[model samples]
Target: MTPPPGWYRDPKAPHLERWWDGTAWTEHRRTPEVTAPVPVAGASGRAKAVAVTTAAVVLVAAIVTGAVVLGQGDEEGAEIETAPTYYTQAPTTEPPSPTPTQSEPSADDPAVVTDELNGITLPLLDGWVRPKYVAEDDVVMTTDGTYDCPADGGVCRHGLVMSRTVTSNDERSPEALAKEDIKEAAESAYDRDTIGRRPYGGMESHEVVKSGPVAVAGRAGWFVRWRVTTAEGPGGYVQSTVFPSRVGTESPVCVRYVFDAGADGPPLADMDRITKGIRSVDDPDGGGGVGSSVGPGEG
Candidate 1:
């Protein structure tokens, strides 16, 4: 039997309690009756206080593999904290809900980076590491090290792979979405980031190198790739991949890749390998899994 709706320790942020609305996690959150933080060595009491406070406001990053690194600041040498926080909702009883579709964290596996919400898992290849910042339904993996960013006087990774279930756009064809996303993906990766971080010294220009049909998780898809030239560092390659998800409602999904065009960057072939390795969490063999009976439209 499904547990009745109640407050429970959040599977992601254990110190705080999240409301379990019988079937899923809700927006409601409250402090636990008693909570003890997992202590970190070298962290001052003040820092720990700040971390606890900051975590409450932004329960974004969850462990795709290990800990999520939260940057304290950009004061030349601010300490970074690798806190094992952020979570899904956990039920009270030992026996859990039999229906996997009841929760977004149903397929969660800490041993590998899996986006249960998106119903897909990207391959964890050598030279790549689970990123420090991952939001709900969004997954990102990047190179293990960073390089000096020429424009922003910051550090930048030479490679990146990110994925998310597409919900904003109404376009149904994967090809159309892929074609449209290539430009934005290039700008985001090479030119500037959300916080105006000019990591690649700002992209100078870009040209399409590849565009065509592809297959992901046994679903037909489309991908568009570009070679970008930047004002600093080595230029990079960026691509936008779109495919229909095997999850509920056949939702569209988007995955993007970035590789700095230099020796330090991941091998270009790795992109193809990664794409080929994409598989649904429910369909590890890439058989596309079973489609949801629930969908939009009039029967």
Candidate 2:
């Protein structure tokens, strides 16, 4: 009868009774008893706020996958520090070029053509063998001829009017008349005992079968073609000379010709037509003109 403040067990409940009230335990009624106090129902607090927003969305997706794997390992360590490295260098070139040379003419080259023999001329048959006497110390008296050139042999009779001898009687000093006309043409065309018996006789004994330098009329001359070897062999003698120092003393003259030996003649073509037909018998006070008379059968 006294178990009424809280839990009690009887009627064959075999000893169960809890009734303390001054401090704890009191939901009475034995094993069939349940004390009520759980009452939060805002739909179960919205299912506990949906499990705390699914644990803060799995902790912000694991801190954004550890900041995208530490920004892909800091972009693979800045792409291995911006890669590029290789070695072996040597190559750079340029150098090579030069060549050229050729030119000749000079021995005091005065338009080389010092006449020894040029084209022979004469009053030449049409002028019908004139030129009879013309000599001023040497000798030129033409009156023995019959030349008809159709290549030698057509009709060439004979010819001679030799004169050109000046061993310096001071032929009015044109350098002693060119050293006495080259020592009188080396003593009448070299015959040093028949040029010491032939065979390239010391280069045909000072061979100069023709030399040149002539103006003639206006004074100034030098022509020569000398060669001799008798018994009808080598014979070519042509001489020309003119010296008057621009007409002061006026008396140096020589012209000769004797081309024998088969005479197809070519002593510098007859001493360049006798020093280019020497002329000038007038006009002398220096205005040029003094080489007069030349007649190895004048042309």
Candidate 3:
């Protein structure tokens, strides 16, 4: 026997309903009425409207529950990424780490060494270097860098120049100071350097090589030079040159030089040449290494 015409589960889509006529399935189909309200057989208009509203709310609840429960797993099924409410959380994260930094020095160039207290600049000769973190504050320049002292002590350099403003002494004459400082200059540069290495062993004896008037930075100056023989290595020369500064209280400024007499030394003529190259820092053509009048930090 065949069932009478009515709505029933659809053959093609089990979740939907279809209508059957007396003889065959009809084209009419709809969602299964799983959550639709059921009304009393005698319900009036207002009662039916209330029932419909109730069903809508229940239908929404069922749909949310289904999504939470049935939507769990991925290869199997993935959980619903969103919640029943409006707000959803953004993925958690952290910012990238910060980097560190440092600064490289620009002291490689053999630059002009300055005497700020005296308003003058010293010129660098070939093979000379104005190094960094190596010489003392009073040291303005040196030659051929440095090496292990033959004495097996500290380090040693073959040639050096130093400068200082004349203060703390009652006598201000350039000539007196130049003569007086020669012995001390020789002792400091050859007998023993700052680090206490006697690179020339020790000053065995010295004789005045020259004593005369000179000029420095456009000012009259006096200088005393000595030829020093050491107990070790080749002999060398030491000079103390002093002049009145062109700035400040016109205080005298003293410049000293020590040159190795070995084959590797700068020619003795370079001492006079360097003195001649001295110029006022304020001069238009003076103190130009690193392209400008740049002051170096204490070595």
Q: Report the poorest 10 consecutive residues by lDDT, candidate 1.
A: 290-299
Against the reference, the lDDT scores of all candidates come to 0.71, 0.38, 0.71
Clash totals, every prediction: 4, 15, 3
For model 3, residues 88-176, the per-residue Cα lDDT tens digits are 23323488787866533143434466656557778778887765555554667778677665553666677777777767587888899
Query: Per-residue alpha-carbon lDDT of model 2 for 46-126, expressed as tens digits?
Result: 676676655555433332110011234464564211111111222223555545544232323222211112211222211
Cand. 2 Cα-lDDT: 0.38
TM-scores, one per candidate: 0.57, 0.23, 0.58
Candidate 3 accuracy as TM-score: 0.58
Q: Given candidate 3, what's the lDDT at residue 76?
A: 73
- List candidate 3 segments past 4 Å from native: 1-111, 135-137, 195-197, 285-297
| TM-score leaderboard ranking | 3, 1, 2
Q: Kindly report which residue stretches of model 2 are placed more than 4 angstroms away from their true locations once superposed.
A: 1-169, 173-183, 186-190, 193-215, 220-229, 245-260, 267-269, 272-274, 277-299
Candidate 2: give its CA RMSD in angstroms: 43.8
Report lDDT (Cα) of residue 49, candidate 2.
68
